[model samples]
Target: MDKFNRKSIVLLVGLALLLALPPITIAMEEAYFISLFSRIMIYALAAVSLDLILGYAGMASLGHGAFLGVGAYAVGILAFHVTEETAIPFLPGGWAGSINAVISWGSAIVVSSLFALVIGALSLRTSGVYFIMITLAFAQMLFFFFVSLTTYGGEDGINLDQRSQIPGLDLADDASFYYVCLALLLAFVYICYRIVNSRFGMVMRGCKQNETRMRALGYSTYRYKLICFVIAGAGAGLAGALIANQSEFVGPGLMHWTRSGEVMIMVILGGMGTIFGPIFGAVALLLMEEVLAAYTEHWMIILGPVLIFVVLFARRGIYGFLTGDGGRDG
Candidate 1:
């Protein structure tokens, strides 16, 4: 088989194994694994979204976690009104009596996209460290805004009384929710693959490679970057919505700069610009954290050195190393 086919088969096998995890955990009577993997999948989704802008488009956004928090709060705030049987405060409509997962998720994406557009439009004018600092500042602003909103529990955060209703699925069930997250992750991966291979993706990459040349050729790199940023924000919002449901809570902490750093780390550690790399990174980092935490309280002390070693030696990250694609093109 060709290299492409071999790689495809490997990815398929890995996905198959992930799909089997719920049943395997059930058989072993280890229910916590389901929750753990579900959380991993959610973070993986966020990381994948970050990879699109950071890896493919060469936009080093340091506040990507803000989108996640926006999505979660969108769902949380909507559900809060639903439970309270009151109209959304500041909206023109009547009480949003029944909370629907579909609507909630859609709202999350829309809200995050809007936020991304505002941030990207401003930040894209700058480059390098300026862009990173501006994005981080915007994210911090939102974090504090949410923290000061005492109605939503402020620093204490808000909790859902129940998972949003999705026609027939029992989202409250851990296994079912895990499957939902996994399905979304697969779909997001496929969508991102298509986007990365399309004409728009080509232009975005060209701008990344040589922005001056692209501008000289009459291409507006700013617009392209802004659109890509919005797309990534929408994806992160979806992940955040799922995470809110999974944990049955939402808070400003989701948008914290540290959380954004974590997702960025996942992208770099997995293999920046590689579509499937972030997923591998998420699994590896989270799993290592779990294992190391079990052995020591200062798990990061050990993990930090190991990560540095990988960066120096592996270069391509675990996925790239394994696939022999070291992300040189990326």
Candidate 2:
């Protein structure tokens, strides 16, 4: 088999092996670990989306967390009334409850994409640090707006009454949720692989490396960047929705700039330039958080210096440190 096919086979084998593991359920006491992993995967998905625009498409957006917030709230608010309605109100008549969750997710993507469009349009007019600042400004706008809302958690957050039920499935269980997140994670990785290997993704990557050169080559790199930003925003929104469903909760903290910074750290720590790097980064960070927090309440005290050390020494993060070639391997 060719190198790529061989790699694919290996990955399939790994997945099959995981599935064959005796179905292990987290005990009630240890269930939080599974939930934490679910949260980490959701955040990792958002970071991967950011990598597509920032690492691959030459865009800097500080408001990416806002899109995640958009998604989480979409699920939380709809699940709000879903139990009340025999049918979902989020959709026009026929699509309430389980179907409403899907529709709300769709709306979240659409809404976040529209917001990204406006943000990218305005930010693309600037370059470098200015672009970053503008994105941050938009994020702050949303953050403050969410904080000011008197209803729906406002500054504080609330939990869902119960998990949103799927039409023909019972995914509310912790193990089931973990499996669902795993499926989405694998699907997203495959989608990202396809995107990076495609012509459109090539143009986006070219813009990131040298926008002027791309423009001189007769492509409007701004348009490409904007398109990528919208897609990334939509993807982040989807991640948010999944997270909300996972927790049966939503909060404004999901949109805070600190949250944005955390995602960047995860992306960089895992390997920002590589497609699968962010997943490793996310898992590592979450694992650290879970493990360290067990020993002490001040987990960030340990994490802070470790992240800096990695940034200084590893440079390209764990993936780069492990695979020095640093180019796409799989």
Candidate whose lDDT is highest = 1
Q: Tell me how far the alpha carbon of residue 169 in candidate 2 is from the true structure, in angstroms, after superposition.
A: 1.4
Candidate 2, lDDT over the whole model = 0.75
lDDT of 2 by residue, 1-330 (tens): 455565465456646643433253243356566677778778778888887877677676777898898888777767655655555444586654443555777777787788778888888888889988888888888888888875567887657876655666666776677777777777777787788779988998888787788889999888888888888888898888888888777888888898887788788788776766677688788889879998998998988998888778775677666555345422
Clashes of each: 0, 1
Colliding pairs, model 1: none
Worst 10 residues of 2 by lDDT: 18-27
Q: Write the per-residue lDDT of candidate 1 for residues 45-143, one digit (tens) a residue.
A: 999999999888989999999999999999999998888887877677675634698899989999999999998999999998999999999999999
User: Model 2: residues >4 Å from true position, as ranges?
Assistant: 1-22, 25-29, 83-99, 328-330
